[model samples]
Target: MTTKSLSIPLDFPFPSPKAHPLLTLHSKIQFPCKFPLFSLPQRIQFLRNQCPPKCQNPNDNNNPVPYTSQQEAHFTETQEAISQFLQEFGISAAESNSIALNSPKYAKMLFDSVKDLEEWTSWKSGGDGNEFATLGFKEKVAYMAKEKGDNGKVAFLESLGLSLSSSMNVARYLHGESLPNLIHKVKYMKEILFSDSDDKRLVGKYARCMMMNLSIPIDEDLQQTLSLFEKVEARRGGLDMLGSSEVTFRCLVESFPRILLLPLDLHLKPMVEFLDSVGVPKEHMREIFLLFPPVIICDITGINRKVQALKKVWAFDKDFGKMLLKYPWILSTAIQKNYKEIVSFFHMEKVDKSSVDTAIRSWPHILGCSTSKLEVMVEQLAKLGIRNKKLGQVISKSPQLLLRKPQEFLQVVLFLEDLGFDRETVGQVASRCPEIFAASIEKTLKKKIEFLDRIGVSKDHLPRVIKKYPELLVSDVNRTILPRMKYLKDVGLSKKDIAFMVRRFSPLLGYSIEEVLRPKYEFLVNTMKKPVEDVVGYPRYFSYSLEKKIMPRFWVLKGRNIECSLKDMLAKNDEEFAADFMGF
Candidate 1:
C-alpha cells in the first residue's frame, strides 16, 4: 500500500499483468477487445437479424419516429410559400409538372432554377434522359430556385449545367401566356439549343411546343417568327422535332385545310387556285374539306357548276357566249346549286328531268332565249324525236335556226309540204316567212356588209328554189327585178324607184329598206365630204361635233403612235403629236 508507483511507458506495447483486474476488464472493453467491433454494416445486420424476432412478438408499437414540430412547421411553411408564389405568378401549383408550368413568368423562373436539381437526381436515379422521363436533380434544383424567387439567379445556374432547363423554360414562355416576352427569349434559347449538339431533344421539344401554342390567325411578326423556325429546321434537318410533337404537327396539317376553306389572307389566293387546278387527291382533300363549314362548300361548288352549265349552252351565241364565259365560275355555281335558277336564266318556266333532257338535245340552239329558257328548249327537243347526236348535227347545220320561232318555222315547213311542196320548197317557204327568221337579221346584215352593188338573188340557190316551187312566184318581177329597177330609175323613177327596189327585195335580202338606205346615205356622205349632219338634217349639230371634232380627237388619242422621224412630230399631224405626248 506504500506509494511504490511506477510510470507506465508511453509507447507500451501491452497492458501490464500487474494492473487491477477491474482495470484490466475496463481496458479490455475500451481498447484491446479482440472480438469484431460492431461496425455500421454489422449494426445494420444485427438490426435486420433482430427484426424478424422482434416482429414475431407483434404488439410492439414501433411507431415511425414522429415528426418534430419544428420540422413539420418548416415543411408547412415551405408548402405555403410555394402556394403563394404560384398564385402571385398566375400559375397553378396543381400543374407543377405539366408543360404549363413553364408558361408563366414565375413558373419559368422556378423551372429554370429547380429543374436542374430534379434532372440530376433523376439521372442519378437511372432516368432514361427522355423528355418524358422524370426530371433530374439539376432540373429540380432549377425549379426550386425559380420557386424561391430567383429567376435571374436561375438563369445564372443555366449557364453552369442547366442549359436544357433554361431553354425549355424559354420555349414555354414563347408558347404560354407571356408570348411577347417569350418571343425574344426564344431567340436566345434557339441559338443555345441549335448551337450545341447535346441539347437537340430539348430544342426539339421547345420548337414543337411553340408551334402548337401559336395563334391560328398569325400576324406578320408571328409569321416571321414561324419563318425563322422553318428556316432553321430546314437548314438543320430538325423537322423531326416538329413531326414528333403531336400538337405541333396536327396544327400544321390543319393549316392547309383552313386556308383552303376561308383563305383569310389574300396571300393564300394563288395557293388555293393552284391546289384547285392540280386537285388534291380525293381522299386527302375530302378529309380536310369536310372541316369547312357546309355552307361555304355549297357556295363554292354551286358557283363552279353554274359557270360550266352556262358555257355549255351559250358557246355558240357569240357576243352572249362571250359575256357568259367571262363569269364561268359564277354561272357554274348557280347551275349546280339551283337548277331552277339555271333554267330560269334561259327563260324556262320550269326545270325538271325532262327540261334537262330537252336542253341537252337542243345542243347549239340556245341563242334565242336567256340561257335558262334555252335549257327548256333543249329539254323539249330531247322529248321530241331528236336524239342528242342527231340534235347536235342539226344544230351545227343550221345554227341560225335558234334565232327563229320554233312553232312558226315548223308550221311553215309542214304547210309547204301539205301544199305538195318538196323539202327544197319547204326551205324556201320557211326562209320567206318573217316569223321564221330572227327579227335582228336585217340590222345584222346591214351592219355586216356596208355596201351591196348588185341586188339580184343568186341563180345557184334560186334555181333550186324555183324548180321546187315554180308556182309560188310566176311574175317576172321576181326574176328580172334588178333590171326593171334600173330602167325605172333611169326614166324619172327618182328615189321612188330606189325605194321600190328596196321594199321589193328586203325580204329576199334579209333586211329592211331603212337599214339598207342608211348605209347608202353614209356611203354618199363619206364620198362627197358633205357633213353627215348637214345631209341628214340633225338639228343639234351633235353629229357634226362628234364626227368632225370628238371622233377625230378620240382616234388621235386612242391610236397607237408611229415610230416616225422627228419631222412627223413637228408637222401638222395633230394625231402624231397627241400620240407622242400620250406615250401611245
Candidate 2:
C-alpha cells in the first residue's frame, strides 16, 4: 500500500488553552512542524482548558463533572478542564463528573490522545467532516498507531486480549509515544522478553512501562537515538536472558526510565555481552539494570575500563562477578570516581589501598554511597576503636557498614550497651556481625530479642548470649531460630531446655536442624545410648564436628566402658581427654 503523506495547511492552528483570550494569537499559532512540540503536562493542561465554556452539543439532563479542590497542585483546574472537554465531546454531565472525579489524571491522558487524533485526522484527510467522529476513543488511537497509514496498530491492539475500552487506554499510552518508537519498543520487548511466550498481554504490560517513559522525549525533543531496537534478533545459543518472567521485565523497565528509548545494538546488546563476559548470568541481568540504570546508557568502553581496573588491582573471579551483580553501579563512571575518592581517603588514613579495595569488593554498594556518608560512618566507628587500619579491617570484613546512616549505627551500639554489652564488647560485636547495625530496630533485632525473652531466656543472660552470638539478632526468628527451637522440642528437649542451652551457647540455635542438630540428636539418642537430656546440659554438643570430634571421642569412651556427663565427655580438649579419660 502507498503511504499517504499528512498535509497540514500552512494556517493550521495549534491549541493553546493556557493563553488568555485577549492574547488569542498564541491559540491560533501555526505549527510548521508535524506533531505538536509541547511537553506531556502542557498537552494535558491544554486539553483540560480546551473544555469549551458552552458545549455546542451539550446534553443538559445531568450536572457536569464537579470542579473540586485537591491537595495536588492544579487538581481543581484539571477537573474543571476535563469536565468541559468531556461535555464538548457530548458526554453527559454525570459521566463527565464521574470520569473527572475518579481519576482526572488518566482522563487528561485520554482527552489529550483523543484530541490529538482528531486534529491529526483532520490534517490527514483534508478537512473531511471528522472521519474519526463516528469512531470510539480506542479506535482513534489505534488509527494513530498506523504503520504507513494502514491497519497495523488496529490489528495489533485487537490481538492483545483487551476490552475495546482497555485497548483504547493502552492506545492512549501508545499514541503519546511516536509511532515508530512504539513499533521498535514493542518489537524489542517481544524479542528480548517475550519471545517464547504466546501471551500477548505480557507484551502490552511491558510496552506500557517502557514505551512512554516520562524521562524520555517524545515528538518535541530530539529524536535521533539510533533505531537499534529495530532488526534486533532474539538471544541465540541458549543465552541466559536477563530474566524471563513478566514481573522482572516490568521491574527492570520501571527501574530504568529510558530503557525502551535506548537503541538495542549500540546500548543494550553490547552491555548484555559485556555483563555475560564478566560472568554475570543472564538471569541476573534484571538486577544489574535495576540497580544501575545508567549502565545501559553509559559507554560500554568506560564500563570495560572499570572492570579492567578492578581485575588489574584485585580480580573478577566468580566472586568479583558476584560483586558486580550485587552492585552493578560499581561500573558507573561516577561510582568509579567515588571508589577512587574512598581509596584516597583510606590511604591518607594509613589504610592500605589493598584493604580499601577488599572493602569495596566485599561491599561494592559502598561505591555508590556518598563519600560524605562514608566519612560520617567513619567518625561513628572511630568512637568504637574502628579507625585507621582497624577501620579498614572492619570495613573489609563488613563493608556494608558504610551504607548505614551514622545515627542508625549508633542506635545499634546504644541498644547493645543498654543490653549490658560494654563499649569494648559492643565494638567486638560490630566487628563480628556488622550487619546488625543495619537491621531494622523494630522488625529484626528487637523481634529476635523479644522472641528469645518470651521463650524464657532471662534478662541477665541476654547480654552474654547476644554478645557471644550477635548474628542471632540477624537470623529470622520464624524461619531460622524458631524452627530450630521447635526441632529441639520435638527431639525431647523442652522449651526451657532449649532456652538454658541457648543462654550458654547462643550460636547453638543458628545451626542447621537437618545438617548438624538432627544427626547429632539422633545419634545421641539411638547410638550413643546417651539420653537426649545430655544435650540440654551441654548445647555445645551441636557445635562439635560429628565425625571429627564428637564421634571419635564418644567411640573411645564407649570402648573404654566410660560413663560421664555431657560436659566431661565433650568439653575436655582432646589431649586432656586422652590423658584423663583414656589414661594416656
Evaluate model 2: give its lDDT: 0.59
lDDT at residue 104 of model 2 (Cα atoms): 29
lDDT of each: 0.34, 0.59
Q: Model 1 over residues 145-230: C-alpha lDDT tens digits?
A: 34333333222222222233343333333232332232233333233123323433544454454354222243333453355356
* Candidate 2, 96-148: lDDT as tens digits: 54444433223333344446556666557536435456664434433333321
Q: TM-scores of all models?
A: 0.20, 0.60
Model 1, C-alpha of 256: deviation from truth (Å) = 21
Candidate 1 residue 411 Cα shift, in angstroms, is 6.9
Worst 10 residues of 1 by lDDT: 26-35
